[model samples]
Structure formats: C-alpha cells, structure tokens
Target: SQRVMETMAEDGTLPRNAVRIFWSSPGYSHCCFTSQNNLDPKLAAEIESAFLSVTDEDPIGKAVLEGEACRSFVPGTDIGWEMIEKAAEAEGLI
Candidate 1:
C-alpha cells in the first residue's frame, strides 16, 4: 500500500491523485493509494480487473487486487459533509 501511504502523506485521503498502477516485482504488479476521493466507479472497476489479470503469482499482485477491490467500493467525497469542511479549510473560508 505504498501508493496509499504516499497519498495519505500528500493529502489526508486517497483521492484521484493518490492511486496508481505500477510494476512492483518483475511480472507482479502493485497498486497503491494514499487516499480515496472523487474516484470514478467505472475506472476503478477497470483498474480492479487489470489488477486481477496479472499472471504473476506473487503476493504483491494479490495484495494489489485486494486493495483495488477495497478502494473501488469507497464512495467518493461528494457524499459526505466532511468534504465540505475540508474544502472550507482549504480555502481558509471556514
């Protein structure tokens, strides 16, 4: 979950700029997310499918697939009041 960790470090949640797909070890792949916000469901599903298709039998691939699935289910920030607060905080308009 290095991507997730990185995203969290940059922004408090895993949002559009937080998640990414890349090769971790040889044929194995890794998907990391530092935040989950404003994620498109269709795109998420496609990414999930891609992760699942990796032929490498490495644990990193499995972990990436599981992480993708978990992230895919997360509702974007649009549905919550917390995002409003965050927005206000960002604009210094709170």
Candidate 2:
C-alpha cells in the first residue's frame, strides 16, 4: 500500500493536500486523510460523504478492497507534482 502511494506520488496522481493513506488488515477498509489547510470543513465533510457513498455502493467497496487503489479528483484543482513529491518525502515513502 505504501508502494502504491509512492507510485501515485511519483506519477502526479495524488490529490492536493493528501497527507496519508491507510490500509486495513482485512484489506478492504481504507481511509485517506488530507491536510485541512485552506479547506472548508463543510466541503471536506461533503467530500468524505461522497467517498463513503461510493464505497457503500454495490460492489464498489469490494472492488476498492480488492483493487489496487482508489482515487479522487476535484475538478479544476491543480495538484502539482511538487506537492506529491513533498508528501512522499514527508512520509518517507519516496
């Protein structure tokens, strides 16, 4: 899982302010925590709700549990590669 996060960071696919990716032992339950700076709490809640909705949808949770990775993108947001690299470095994942 750490390798996957590092790959995403290297590939510039990780979202802005993405702080951590956690994988559970059951191999299905996972959560991504992001930095709260410059973000609205309500919006963050909405995004988390959206993630949960998608995860709860039929077979999506199973897919996420079994699949390689789960991704989220905010339209019009530009998450530069530098941020990803920094995140990877901070986590010692690079």
Candidate 3:
C-alpha cells in the first residue's frame, strides 16, 4: 500500500500534501484531507477521489475497507471489547 501511494505520488496521481493518516488502534485507521486547507474544495475532492479510487482498487485497501465494514456493520464482531470501546468513547467525548 505504501509503495502504491509512493508510486502515485511520483506519477502525480496524488498531491504531495494530500492527506494526514492516523491509526486509531486495533487495526482501525483513517485519512484526513489536509489538502482542503491549501486547495479549493473541488481540487481537494478530486485528490481524495483519486486516492480513494486507487486504494479501492488496491488489494490492501480493499481488505482494510472490508475489515472496517465488518467491524462497523456486521453482527458478532470483536467490537464489543468494552474496555477499548469505552476508552475510544471517552476520548471522543473529550
């Protein structure tokens, strides 16, 4: 995935300051479009769309999205680990 992102960056498929990535923990992660602050909304949208399009087609990104989907919407998930969930909830509230 990193290699794909690097290649895209090299090829100008994605802007250099496109995103700020964060991993919340326990396999969850997210991307923030920092480009929005520097670029217009349309340009930011395009960059995000391009990134998403490439990632959606990439195997690793597909797997990550699948895992996120399962954890979020599927029944009987490991999401019920209350200790971690409570921490996440608490932090969000703060």
Candidate 4:
C-alpha cells in the first residue's frame, strides 16, 4: 500500500484515482476501499452503518476504533489482552 501510494504521488495519479478509481467512507478517511468510485449514496450509508456496528460490538473492533483515534492498535478492554496475559502468566507462559 505504501509503495502504491508513493507511485501514485510520483506519477500524479492520486487525484485521478481518488475520484475515479477509489472512494473512502466519510466516517473513516483511512478506510479507503470501494468497489466503485460512484457508489450509490444509500449503499454507502448502509455500508458505513454496518462498519460502525462492527466497531461498536466487537472487542477487537473497539481496539481498532481506539487505535484510529490514537495511533497503534494495542490490546486492551477490547479482546481482553490483559486478562489473557494474566492467565498465561498463571500458567508460567510469561
């Protein structure tokens, strides 16, 4: 992805691909994957809602959302990494 975007910038292809080849969700800027540049507004809204629902419900999804706000995606309440670590330590894994 880095190399592709770098090539895009070097070749002045970013703008063209942005509006022509790819579309991002309004809710998430870095979430840049779309089947069509001209996705229907209604469908986009539905997709966004689905994405948000997953983010809201799943523990790992919460970590993703938090990481989106911050920087790196580290384990926390979402997925209970701390609890897992404690269990592992109890079993002498750490």
lDDT string, candidate 1, 1-94, tens digits: 5645675767866655555666554422123332255788788777766644653266766566465644232222233357757998999976
Backbone clash pairs for candidate 4 read none
Q: Against the correct fold, how does model 2 do in TM-score? A: 0.32
Best by TM-score: 2
* Tens digit per residue, CA lDDT, model 2, 26-91: 433234356446799799778767655655245866576446355432222334457777998999
| Order of candidate numbers by lDDT, starting with the best | 2, 4, 3, 1
Using lDDT, give the best candidate's number. 2
- What would the per-residue lDDT of candidate 4 be over residues 3-94, giving only the tens digit for each residue? 45766877998854463435543432343334455899899777766654655357787787765553433221233256766998999967
| Least well predicted 10-residue stretch by lDDT in candidate 4 | 71-80
RMSD of every prediction: 15.2, 14.6, 15.2, 17.4
> Ten-residue segment with the worst summed lDDT in candidate 3?
69-78
Per-residue alpha-carbon lDDT of candidate 3 for residues 16-88, written as tens digits (9 for 90 to 100): 7686445334543342224324578787667656555544456777786665543222112344457865887
CA lDDT, every prediction? 0.54, 0.59, 0.54, 0.56
Better of 2 and 3 by TM-score: 2
Clashes of each: 12, 0, 0, 0
Q: Which wins on TM-score, candidate 1 or candidate 2? A: 2
> 1 or 4, which is superior by TM-score?
4
